[model samples]
Target chain A: MTLAASPHHILTVTVENKPGVLSRVAGLFSRRAFNIVSLAVSPTDDERFSRMTIVVDAESAPLEQVVKQLNKLIPVIKITEVPPAEGVERELMLVIVKAAAETRGQVTELTAIFEAKIVDVGYDAMTIMVVGEPEKLDAFSDLVKPFGIVELQRTGRIALPKLARESTRLRSVKTARA
Target chain B: MKLTGAQALIKSLEMEQVEVMFGLPGGAILPVYDPLIDSSIRHILVRHEQGAGHMASGYAHATGRPGVAMVTSGPAATNIVTPLCDAYMDSIPVVVITGQVAYSVIGTDAFQEADTVGITMPVTKHNWLISDAQDIPRVVREAFHVATTGRPGPVLIDLPKDVANAPMEWYWPEKVDMPGYKPNVKGHPRQIKDAAKLINEARRPVIYAGGGIMLANASNELRALAELTGLPAVTTLMGRGALPDEHPLCLGMPGMHGNFTAVTAMQKADLLITLGARFDDRVTGKVSTFAPDAKVIHVDIDPAELGKVRLADVPIVGDLRTVIDEMIKALKSERSKQDPPDLAPWLATIHDWQERYPLKYRQEEGGPLKPQFVIESLRDNTPDDCILVSGVGQHQMWASQLWKFKLPNTWVNSGGLGTMGYAVPAAVGAKVGRPDRMVWAIDGDGCFQMTAQELVTAASERIPVKIAILNNAYLGMVRQWQELFYEERYSEVYLSPDLPDYVKWAEAMGCVGMRVDTADDVVATIEKANEIDDRPVVIDFRTDWREKVYPMVAAGSSNDDIILGPEFGEGGR
Candidate 1:
C-alpha cells in the first residue's frame, strides 16, 4: 500500500501576554519534536494577550496531539487550525542577489515580473523585497536562485481565516427576499 | 485587605483548602516562608528538594487531590526537575512553586538565579512567572485549575523575590478564564451506542482499563461494566487496583511483566474495550502483533491518546466515569435481550491459561529466599488496606504481580517514568496524607541507595512509613538483562552486600531497621516493622539475587514470545 503523507497545517494560538509564555510554547513544540515550519507572534488589540500563527508540518507529528498539548498550556487562551484553502497566508522575503552592471537589467526585469520592489542597491548586489503568499515567495525565490544570490531572509508566514457572512444571516436574508 | 504577595499566596492556598505542603526554604523563598508562620497549612521540611516534589506527588496519588511543593531558586529549582518529569510522565496533578531572583535582576543572571521557568517549561502542563504582586491570586487559582483538570499533570509557578515582597491588596479571581483548556467530559451518544454494540457482539472481549479509571474515580463503574457484561478485564501497571484483585473478572496487570493469562488473552482477544489507557510501547509489545485480531473501542479523556499509537474502531473521548456511565446505560438495554451472546467458552479458555501458567516461583528446601516468595509473605501478613509503593526494578514488578490490590489508590509506584528512587518519599507522603493506613515502600538495594536520605525527613516528621528493602546485592533487573541479552558479561551491576549496612544506616537516621536473611524471618520481621507507628522502620530482606521476573516479553518483541520461568516446566527460557 502507498503511504499517504499528511499535509502541513497552520495553527493559530492565542495566549496571555506574560513573561516566558513564548518560551513555554516553543519549548512544547521542541520537546515533542514537531517541526514548526514558520511562526509569527504579535500582541493582540488587547494588551493582556498575544496571538501566534504557527505553520506546523503535520506529516512529521500527529497534528491532533500537538493541538491537544497546546491546549494544556495555561496561558494559551484559544487555538484554531486554519485549513490551507479557508485561510489567507502571507510572507515577506528580502533577497540580496549579485547584480553587476552586466546582470542588472535581467535582475530588474525579473523583479518587475514578480512585482517586487528594490529595497537597496550596492556596487555588486541589489536587495529586493517581495510580499505575497508563501507559495508566491517560494516561486520568486526559485526564480532568483540562478542569479548567484548573496543573501536571503523571510518573515515566516502569518495567516487569518477568510472573512465570510454567517450562513444563518445569509439564509435569513434570502428568506426575507423570497 | 492590603497584604504582601507572600501573604496573598498563603491566603489563596487556604482558600483552595490546602492542608499540607512539602518543601525546603532558602534565601529567595524566605519571603514566602515568613507568611507560612501564621498560615494554617502544615509544611513538612524535606531533606532534599526532590523529596519535596515526590512527596507532593505521593500525596496527590493517595488522596486524589493536587499535591503542593515549594522550593527556592537555582540549585533547589534544578533538583526538583526529576520529580516534575516523573509527575509529568505519570500524569499526576502536582503544583510546584519555586523562588526566583528579583524580577529586576532576572535577565542579568543574578546570584542564585537559574531561569526556573525556562528549565521547567517542557515538563510542566503549564507555568507562570509572577512579575506583578496583583497577579498572585489569579495565578494561584489558574495554577491549581490547570494542574488538576483534563489530563492532569504537574504545573509550576515561579515567584520572583521582588514579587513576593511587593505589597498589594489581594483579591481572588471568581472564575478561571481558560477557554482553550476545556476537556471534553461527555461522550457522544452515537459513539457510546457504537461501543456498547461492539461490546455486546464480541465473544472474546476484554476490558483493558488504565489509570484513567482511578483519575476519574470510575472504578465502581468499571467493575459494574465488567460484572454486568460478564467480561474479563486486565489493567495496565498504572491501572492496578481499579478493580479488586479477587474480583472474578479481574485478570490483573497486562504488559512486560504481567501475568501469563493477561498476555495471552490480549494476543487472542477478538475485541478490546480500552478505557483511559494509552497504548504505550511497553503495553503494546511489537505493535504489529499486539491484540492482532481485536477490534479496539478506545475511550480516554484526551483525544490525542485515542489514535496516537493504534487506530480505534470506535473512539470515545470523554471523562472515563461519564463515558462508562453512558456505556452502562446503553449496555443495560442490550443486556435485557433474552439470548445474549455466550462468552463461556472464552472464559473457560482464559481459566485454563490462568490455571496452567499461574505466576510461579519455588524455593529449594533451605536455599535462598525467592523475591516472589518474600512478596507473597508480605501480602499474606500486611493488612488488606495497607498501601504499597515500590521503586522501579525487578522488585517493583514482583510487587505488581504478587501483591493483590483490593482498593483504589492503594498501589502508588512510579509507573510511567519508572523512576528508581521514588518509593521512600512517596510512601512518606502517602502516610502523611492517609495517617490511618499502613504504608510500605518495597524497594531494591540499588533503588534504595538512590534516595535513602529521605528517611531522615520521614523520621524527623514522624511519618511512620515502613520501608521493606528487597536487598539482592546486585542491580538485579540489569543483571538479569545482562545475563539474558549480553552473554552474562556483567559490567557494573554488582553492589557489595557488605557495603553500608542498611540496618546501621537506618539507625543513623533514627529509624528502626532489621535484617532478615532467611524465609522463616520474613513474617516476624514484617510484623515487628508494622508494630511501630511512632517512627519510620526499614526491614532489609536479603532475597535471592539470581531470581528474575518471569513471563518476560523480551524488549520490543511480541507478547506472544513470553518466556516463562523454569517452574512452568515447558516454556523455560
Candidate 2:
C-alpha cells in the first residue's frame, strides 16, 4: 500500500471529467479529513458513468462525512459504504523478477507458496502473477524481494460487491426500467 | 443496425474537420480501429500514446486548428493525460479520444479498462464519456468547439466499445448549442472605454500579452493597438512571439530569466494594459510588489481569470480581437486627452538597469558546448516563418531570450505547467501543421530525455523537426537549486549511470543524431541537423553541467531584486 493508505471503505461515484473533478473529489476527502487508500475508476460500458471505487483512510465518522461531500458533486451519483470483511476487494499485480538458473528453483518455490503462477520464464528472469486482496499481494511481493525484484507494475485496485449477485439483480431491474 | 461506440466516435470526429489523428493502437480501441478502415481520417501511428496527444497539441499550436488524438483505455489513456495537461496549461486546442469497456461491466473489473475521464478530470479543460449513441455527435461537436475556442485546451471523449458498433444515421451539424459553453466575445463597452482612458492618460504604459493572443489569432489586432497607442510592450513567457521581438517598443519578456530592461520598465509603469494575458507568477514577481503602483486593465476571454490573482481596475471580459479593436476606437475618441508623453526618463532608467545587469554569460570563452550560443545560432539560421518549440526550465528561458520570434503561434511551449517533455512532439505537430516551414525543438538534456522517444514519430512521418538538445547531463534546474539552497550537497542530480548515447539513440529511433562536445562543432552540427531533408535530427551538445542561468529573481521576489551575471545568477545572492 502507498504511504497514504486509507482504511477499507467503498465508494461509487460518477464524474464529468472537466477540469478539477479530481481536485474536487480529493478536496472533499481532505476537507472532511479523510485519506483514500485505494482507488479505481473506469468509464461504464456505455461510456457515461465513470465509476470510482475509493477506499477512505479515515475512521467511520470522517469517511462518512467525506462520502456525503462527494455525493454533493453534480457528477457524483452515489457513494455507498462497504464493510471490508464482507466486500470482495481484489488487486492484480505483475512482478518482473531477476533470477539466475541457480536461484530459479527458489523463486519457483516462493511463487508456489503464494498460489502464484509463473507467467513467463526467460533465460535470466521470470515474471509472476498475483491476484488477491491488496494485503495478500503485498505480503506475497515482500517475500520475493530477497530474490531480487526487477520491477513491479500494478493495475491499481478494482472491486465488486461480496453480494455481487444482488447488485446484478438491481442492475437488471434498473435496465428493465430504463 | 448496430454500431460500436468507437465507430460513432470515428464518425463524429470525421464530421469535425479532423483529417489527422496521432495515437498508438491498443485492445480497448480495436473496435474503433475496425471501423476506421472506412473513414477518411488518417491516424499517424506513434510509438507511445503520450506522443499522440503532444503531436495533436503541436498541430493545434502550429495551424491555429484543433488537433486530435486517439488511444485505448487504461495506461494508454493515462499516457495521454500528461500531454492533455500540457495542452490545458499552455492553452493549445486538442481533442483526445479514448475507448472504454462496455457499460455492463463498469465496476465489475473489466479487462484493459480504466476510468480515463476520472483520472483526467484535473488535467483537461473539459472531457466527456459518451455512453449513448444519441449524445455522441452532439458531445463530439461540443468537445471540438470547446477545445478550439476561447482559451483553447485539450478535451477528451471516451467512447465505449459497444457504442461504436451500434448503428445510427451519421449527420454533421453546422454548429452546436451548448448551454454551459457560452464564451464571452464582446468586451464590456464601459471597461473598454476605461482602458482607453487609462492608456491615453498615462505617462508610462506597457502592453503585456500572452498565449491568448494565439488562441484569439489577435496578433494583428495586438500589433495595431500597440502601434496606435505607442505603448512599449512586454510579453509573458508564453507570449514570446505575440509581437515581433525586434519592435523598438517591445521590452522582451518579464520576470525570472526576463530581461533587466523589461522588468525595470514593468516596475516603472503607471498603467499596465494586460491584454490576452493573466499576470502569471513568473511574470509578476512577488504578488504584492508586482506592478504595485500600476492601475491594471486586464482584458481576457475567460471570466474566471478576472481578479483570480491581481485586481483589475478595468476588467474587460471579451474576445481579444474585439477588445483590442474597441480599445483603439475609444483611444481615438479620447485622443485630445493624451498625456504629455516622454518616456525619456523611463527609458533612461531602463538603459541604466540594462548596463548594470547585462545578460552576459561568464562561462569560458572556448569551453564545452553551451546552449546559449546554440539557441542564438538556431534563431539566426531558422527561417523567418519557422516555428520554435522548447522544453521546460532554463533552456526554455534561453530559447525565449535568444530567439527573435516575429509572429504569434510560431513559438509553442508549456509555460504555466512547465512540462519538460512538451517540445519534441509539439515540434512534430508544428511540422505537420506547416509542412512548408522549418520547425526546431530546443530542449535541455533532462527535458529531451523525458520525451526523446518522439524522434520515432518524426522519422515515421517524414516530419523533420530539428531537436537541439542542450545536454548538461545533470537535471540542470534541480542541480542549480541543490547548489544554491542545499549547500551544493549534489543530491540525486548526477546521472553517472550509463544512459543512452543520444548519437546512436536517434539512429536507433530511425532519425539522424549528432553530438557536439565542443563549441567549435556546434554551428556545423546544427547546420547539418537542419539539412537532413525531411528526417528529424537530434544534436546533443555535451554542455557543462555545473553552471546556472543569470538574471534570476527568486520565485516570489520583487522584479527589482533580480541578481545578474552568471556565477549562479539569482541563486548566488
DockQ of each: 0.59, 0.02
Which segments of candidate 1 are over 4 A away from where they belong?
A1-7, A44-48, A162-178, B337-339, B570-573
TM-score (chain A) of candidate 2? 0.76
* Candidate 2 Cα outliers beyond 4 Å, as residue runs: A1-178, B1-4, B337-340, B362-365, B496-498, B567-573
Model 2, B245-315: lDDT tens digits are: 88866778888888877887788789888887888888888989887779999988876577767888988
Interface RMSD of each candidate, angstroms, one decimal: 2.0, 8.7
Evaluated against the true chain A, what TM-score does chain A of model 1 have?
0.88
Candidate with top lDDT is: 1
The weakest ten consecutive residues by lDDT in model 2 chain B span: B564-573
Q: Model 2's CAPRI class?
A: incorrect
